[model samples]
Target: MKLSKPLIIGIAGGSGSGKTSVTNSIYEVFKEHSVVVIEQDFYYKDQSHLDFEERLLTNYDHPLAFDNKLLISHLRKLLVRQSVEKPIYDYTLHTRSEKSVLIEPKDVIILEGILVLEDEALRNLMDIKLFVDTDADLRIIRRILRDINERGRSIESVVEQYLSVVRPMHNQFIEPTKRYADIIIPEGGHNEVAIDLMVTKIKTILENGTELYYDDDINQ
Candidate 1:
């Protein structure tokens, strides 16, 4: 049997809204199939070329922070089952790393991140676009804790960043993109029913012989 081109699924939310958790949850659900995830974090521009202060001034939450052109190009190729090398970004150092990720077309392709919904071109490529809707306060608290433990940041710094950078960016870029979602899950990973519903839809699409974006009566 000929394998189909990967189905592109996009998940977007504010920081600590459980984007990765949702991706992983769905990934586990569809473990029997070949799945590849394209992380939005990997597309950060090369920060090494900028000074520390300039890099700090860079709006990481801004849609422009991502290499959207490259992402769109890669996703277009991926729709036709082409392989590509995605960048590797190092959060600890806040720089694009030298290494690259070799991504192959699979049964499923998921792209997850805070600003994934912001780019119109990228959004158009998604077979399913999901928004994880967690409240601002909860997202802030989770981000603070996660950054402290995972990224080795102090509580004070985390709070400062959240207030100065995170919140404003969310308002300006991320939150508004919720309207673009084909589906929205509240409280993210806590919504088991929604996750399962999404998984079932994906499975049904595949089982019905729909090749991701193949033109069919229902899908059309």
Candidate 2:
């Protein structure tokens, strides 16, 4: 089927702010059709050459940690109805996987990550930019849990990283980018009202061949 210009949506938030949850909610809504979600995490520069210990020391929360050039190129390709080989990242290994996921052109694309909003070229491509805001304490708690369960991090290491880099980088980069968001969804995906309004906007984009402007009164 002929697709309209792909609606590029970006979800940006600090680690553990439920960016994934909000992205997943949108994906679930469009899972039956031509919609694909790509993660900024997948674009982390390959660190396979570094030893595990050296990779561990890397400040991953910083913008320099990602291969934004590749991400931008892929997004441009997807925008032009071309397919892209999306990189697969290994969180456990702290490197890119040998294999990649081949993504076909879709009507909607969701990009989720901590630093996605920091790049002007990337943010320019997004038709809708969403910022997920959760309390710092809640975010820290979620980060600890995810690092432990999903990434095999020890409690001590999680806390150390949070203090040494994550929190500082979040304050320096992620938190400030909130002002750029077209919509700010407090409490992340738990805010059903916000999610519903986002869905409503997506449906409108699909129905009409145009993008919707961000309105301050969306969820109010």
Candidate 3:
């Protein structure tokens, strides 16, 4: 079966703003449609080279921390109807695993991360851009839980990182990027209606074929 067009959708939010959850919801709806996920988290420079405190201080929220150039290059390939093996990242060790994920050109690619929309070059590749808006307090709580249990962080360290880095960085870079979003979804993954709306958009795109012809358009 020929994939008429590869719809690249970007989901952006601050730390623990449910970016991944929203992404998963989209995937649930469109899983059988042959969609691939390319996460921005995979681009973090290997932090394993550093010590524990140094890795904690490592600004995961910074746009400069990501390999945006490489991400843009991959998106370009996907846009031209090519497949890309996005890197896999592990937060537990603060480094990326050696193995690469092979992703085929599909009907849709749901790209999710904190700074997915931070770069104009990367943003331009998306057919739709969504910003997940959740309260700062709620985000912080989620961050604490995920970091402590999932990412192997301590309570004190999490608080310190939040106050010293995450909050400020979000205000400076991540939050400001919301203005660029084509749509803003409040409450993140819990917003089932919003998720449905996005799924509907993808269905509409497939039916319309207005943006799916990767072979025909160079600028798309």
Candidate 4:
């Protein structure tokens, strides 16, 4: 049987807003099928030409920091039933790896990133858009812990970057894009009610064999 068009979901939020958790929950439910997950961070433009110090100074939270055009092309390919080799970015090294992840065309596509909803072309491609709203205090704390424990960063560096770049970028670019979200999720993946609703909606789209961009603000 021919499968219906893939459902493209965009999950956007500030760093450490639990976007990953929300995405993981959805992925777990649909793991039996062909589901490809992509991260905007993986499409960060190569900074191999720049010194490590220069790369560190790059405004990662800014939309220009990502190779969005490439990402959009990849997503378009997946939508048309074509496989793509997604890039792999190394956070610790501040560079993209030579290797790429081979992702087959999927029945569902989940694009997760802090600035995923900021791009116009990318936004147009999404079947559903979600924004994870979390308090700045909570987000900063989570970012600190994640960077220190997972990304091997020092507490001072993390705090400095948060104050200098992350906070400002989120205020200017990320927060403004919240209006574009079809659903605004508070507390991220911890909100089971919201997650369940979203999952059910996706399942409904699959079962109905059609995509509903909006149904009189049904989910809002």
Q: lDDT of each structure?
A: 0.84, 0.90, 0.84, 0.89
lDDT of 2 by residue, 19-118 (tens): 9999999899988977899999999999989999899888999999999999988987888788999999998899999999999999899999999999
Q: Best lDDT goes to which candidate? A: 2
lDDT of 4 by residue, 1-220 (tens): 3334688999999998989999999999988975778999999999989899899888888889999988988987887678899999999989898899899998789999999999998998899999999999999999999999999899999999999999999999999999999999999979999999998998888887655332222212
TM-scores of all models?
A: 0.91, 0.93, 0.90, 0.93
Better of 2 and 3 by lDDT: 2
- Candidate 1 residues lying further than 4 Å off, grouped into runs, are 1-5, 214-220
Per-residue lDDT of model 3, residues 109-172, tens digit only? 8888898888987886788999999999999999899889888879998998889888999999
Candidate 3 is scored at a TM of 0.90
Q: By lDDT, rank the candidates, best first.
A: 2, 4, 3, 1
Greater lDDT among 1 and 2 belongs to 2
Worst 10 residues of 3 by lDDT: 211-220
Model 2 residue pairs with clashes? none
Clashes of 2: 0
Comparison by lDDT, 1 against 3, better one: 3
